[model samples]
Target: DGQKVTVIATDYTCIGEPVEINVIVSDLPNAFTPGSDGFNDIFGAGAELTIFNRWGQVIYEGTEGWDGKYKGKKVSPGTYYYILSVFDANNTKTTMKGSVTVVSDEK
Candidate 1:
């Protein structure tokens, strides 16, 4: 934990900022509401997420993040697969794979 570091450099011609690289899996809910209730919302930015159905069909392709909707319609509750590729300020990429369950408890 906390094993990441940021480095900054500068020169007489220009000033440089620290490089930010964080592609770790966030502790997010297995399911979330796409209604924008100001809670568990979109995934982390600076990443490309290719979410797939159980049949291995691509359902959503998000370059920044996902809002639990595919083609402007809320998806149904089910188990889904995802392949997340995160990019840092330095253009370095990190990939991750996991599954999430979508559920709703509303009328």
Candidate 2:
């Protein structure tokens, strides 16, 4: 003789939810030298760089790249402050502020 069997099934669904985003700033270099020997010739203002003077005047702004020059001229040797802001690929925004020193061999 042979036997028979029966089966039952169920259905279900999942829902998605929104989440809050946070921003962070990292990988800040301690120091840099802007010599003209072709190595380390340019000064970096950090990621999403935005440099400003003591008076809060904007000196430079760019995307993690700087040639150590402003207005087609080399900047003097000294310390400068910079503010960095960025939005990651996930559309999250972050801001950071820090200081940097610019040195020259002629000094």
Candidate 3:
């Protein structure tokens, strides 16, 4: 039997591309405690967070995040509304709207 031997070489390159992730907030909490419990203590930073009262009044606004406080006082326990606008480098803006309750104690 006559046979011929052949060798094949393969080359590959891992071309990587920068990937942009989705909004960091996947599970938006409906409530949080501002105390130092190490839990949902602060709002998402870099987000234009505007919290409104039940009457649609801006109760709190901060870019560093809200600690569930208004005017250095812990807001009362009640249903509050919020709007979060996140701006990226490309000027792409994402918005999230929901309600959050401020609780004095963990429940």
Which numbered prediction scores highest in TM-score against the true structure? Answer: 3
Error of 1 at 46 (Å): 3.1
Give a tens-digit lDDT track for model 2, residues 1-107: 01222333334664444444443436555455665777666555445788776677778889856666678777777777877776665666677778877777564
Question: What are the Cα lDDT values of the candidates?
Answer: 0.70, 0.64, 0.75
Clashing pairs in 3: none
CA error at residue 18 for candidate 1, angstroms:
14
Select the stronger candidate by TM-score from 1 and 2: 1
Q: Against the hidden true structure, what lDDT does model 2 obtain? A: 0.64
Q: What is the descending TM-score order?
A: 3, 1, 2
After the best TM-score superposition of candidate 2, give how far the Cα of residue 100 lies from its true spot, in angstroms: 0.5
| lDDT, residue 60, candidate 2 | 87
Q: Which 10-residue window in model 2 sums to the lowest lDDT?
A: 1-10
Which residue pairs in candidate 2 collide? none
For each candidate, what TM-score against the reference? 0.64, 0.60, 0.69
Best-fitting candidate, scored by lDDT: 3
lDDT of 3 at 18: 48
